[model samples]
Target: MKPFYEKTIHTKPIFQGRMISLQVDEVELPNGQTSTREVVKHPGAVAVMPFTTDGRMVVVRQFRKPLEKEIYEIPAGKLEKGEDPASCALRELEEETGFAAESLQLVTSFYTSPGFADELLYIFEATGLTQGKVHPDEDEFVEAQLISLEEGLELMAAEQIHDAKTVFALMYWQNKRLKAQLGK
Candidate 1:
């Protein structure tokens, strides 16, 4: 009875990987037409926007194999099974940026690709960060740096700061600053 619901008739598992699994689902459309949907299942993830005491935003430059390029993104990582999003946010923030946040606040949770994927992502804002030691995963290579709001804008325009989550974090920061200045 949900709006435009597509009831699944059958699902065939395609491939299962460490982070994601693929499946093809046969569904009956609202209008009685049958079709197949290739879906990606994910264990979810967490992303953090950490701030330095000087107010610069902490970001990581890493190469993404799927993109075949290096991009600047805020600290992020996959959620371990049954992991709390906040804990995952802090873990990623520390592991990627070598910083621990005294304060962590959840900004929002969203589905990255609702059409073909069920990858839910939780975004967090971290303040009062203290530097520590970088300890990325055994196979992960990343370089962390800080950038000003203007620098973030420039990188975004250049596409160095790509990906939806990072772009959303930048926008959120900009909007928060604007609202504060406007006394809202």
Candidate 2:
């Protein structure tokens, strides 16, 4: 089967910014009509679900300028140019939460918003945690909170934690743990 949308023409790099770039493209639709799309290019990012030995999860409360409100989320950050996702995950976890993980396992990856942006997020499970000094960005205001896994789930159910990436990572962990217990 052939795809409905086919790229007929493309205008590359109308503008580029630190976080994203703009590309104008023309595509031929299934109905034999052409349309233009302004695609946003992103450098991808990483998010970490840090679990303490006792089964507590580390999260951060910070203000998101886009949301214009403070929200709780798992530690995450955008990848620097040419940086590995694992390195970015570890760095972001430590910088935001003052904890370092001895082992980080890649859980899954997903697009943040496939409809509009090409932002791919790599999710990781960080374990074997050790306390460290936080190295947050100068402009970043964050407070780290360690909550029980059960409490984290409750927060999600209560609508307190609304970040999509965080929810996805936590849910993935929950499902994995349940499967492990069932096998025991």
Candidate 3:
């Protein structure tokens, strides 16, 4: 079967910025009606789920301006123009958590918010961690912590970790671990 939403008409960017762009599009609905959809174009991003040798997960505590509060999340960053997701994942992991991974594997990729924004997030699993100096952006402020996988699950259950990307990555790993334990 074909998709329901079809792009009947689209207008190029009215304005562009470092992180996003404004675009207007006309789409045909499933009900055979036409409508306009304003979209925010993003350059996509990468999130890293770093695991220490001792089976601990590396998390970052940062104060998000939009939330106006410190939140715990996995290491993540937006991709620079012409940069690859894997490279971005490695760079962000080291920059945010002060740990470099010898092996980085792509876990999954998904859209952050499909309602209006076109932000695709690529998640990676980083292993073989080695300590380094955190080189966060000058405007960025964050604290890194290494928590056990069990502790991370507890944090999720306690509603302490609320970021969507972080939650998704943790749950994905958790499910994988459970399946492995059950010999499936």
Number of the predicted model whose lDDT against the real structure is largest:
1
TM-score of 2: 0.90
Q: Which ranges in model 3 have alpha carbons more than 4 Å from their true place? A: 10-15
Tens-digit lDDT string for candidate 2 (13-92): 68899889988778777888888877889999999999888878899999889888787899999999999999999999
Best first by lDDT, ranked: 1, 3, 2
**lDDT (tens digit, per residue) of candidate 1 on 81-163:** 99999999999998998999999999899999999999999999999999999999999999999999889999999999989
Tell me, by TM-score, which candidate is best. 1
Work out the TM-score per prediction.
0.97, 0.90, 0.89
Clash pairs for candidate 2: none
Off by over 4 Å in 2: 12-15
Q: How many backbone clashes does candidate 1 have?
A: 0
Worst 10 residues of 1 by lDDT: 47-56
lDDT tens digits, residues 59-140, model 3? 9998888887777899999999899999999999999989989999998899999988999999999999999999999999
RMSD in order of candidates: 1.1, 1.9, 2.0
Report the CA-based lDDT of candidate 1 relative to the real structure. 0.94
